[model samples]
Target: MSLPLPATGTKRADRHWWQTACIYQIYPASFKDSNGDGFGDLPGIISKIDHLKSLGVNAVWLSPCYESPNVDGGYDISNYRKIDPRYGTVADIELLIRSLDEVNIRLIMDLVVNHTSDQHEWFRESRSSKTNAKRDWYIWRKGKSITIGNECVRTPPNNWKSQFQGSAWEYDAHTDEYYLHLFAAQQPDLN
Candidate 1:
């Protein structure tokens, strides 16, 4: 899915540098504090692009700029279409995107698709009473009240251990069900 290479013999910021274009990944909070709010904003990013350019990185990848609850380090996105208020307004993202475009530097963003933070609407509803419409959005099973049928698969359907070194199932209070967890109890597996 990669695009075609830039035209040959082109006047560019970095030549022969395409093979070794300067690529930079910035963690906004640690990069700069534009508003002095202890968080990095688009202006902060724009201000630092020169430093990156000086470092010879021809491209940049932003960790995450979309709106989020900041749980799981912003990997749990609340709204992909908006920028987190802690960061800046949506205009900031657009300005950053346009600025990067003008400099011929590519901008990459982190995309999160796993279960969002508990505060996210999906997880909130999934945690509600068992009959909630979004309950099935996450994996949940009926509690241990069922007697196994003759062919009922059980015991984790095998002996596969969760990476967290424990039984994979977690008890849910809402549905009195057991949900699979691939990590800590707090991080319910979205699989």
Candidate 2:
């Protein structure tokens, strides 16, 4: 995986209009579930916008509402192009967007391009045979160290600690090398 580095002389800072609009963050799963599947869906959130609008809120920051494996509590996203099936679908989000617009309320969805659900196609390919074209999408390095017949089996380039509770190195039997995992052993850092 790659950590996109900023240009040598560039500074990028977000300054959206909503920065001063004063909004409330909504954790959809805990908001409400009309279907009672123990998981909240878009319809449930839509049914309650009136409550938020009445509260004088203008913008809503939706938690990781996109499809996820629920790892990292949905913050570790899987896909960037669609809505999570458990919550709803693209159409559901579209309707919510339109409805919110009618009330002058803004809907902001989360984008997690980094590590994805292991089930995500990106991660799937990343963990697959290293020769796969999709492998470079994420950071994959050998174990703490490697050597084959006197040649170095090149480990990850850094001597860094995994932010997660344990060492970041994980051996992949498929590729005979260790890959980096900055978070949970399963939650490898996103590119």
Number of clashing pairs per prediction, in order: 3, 6
Q: Against the hidden reference, what TM-scores do the models get?
A: 0.70, 0.78
* Candidate 1 Cα misplacement greater than 4 A, ranges: 1-21, 129-131, 143-170, 181-191
Per-residue lDDT of candidate 1, residues 144-173 (tens digit): 442477554333323445666787666766
Task: Determine which window of 10 residues in candidate 2 has minimal summed lDDT.
Answer: 11-20
Candidate 2's TM-score reads: 0.78
**Tens-digit per-residue lDDT, 39-90, candidate 2:** 8888898998889899988898898887777867787677777787888888
Candidate 1 has a TM-score of 0.70
**Root-mean-square deviation of Cα positions for candidate 2 versus the true structure, in angstroms:** 7.1
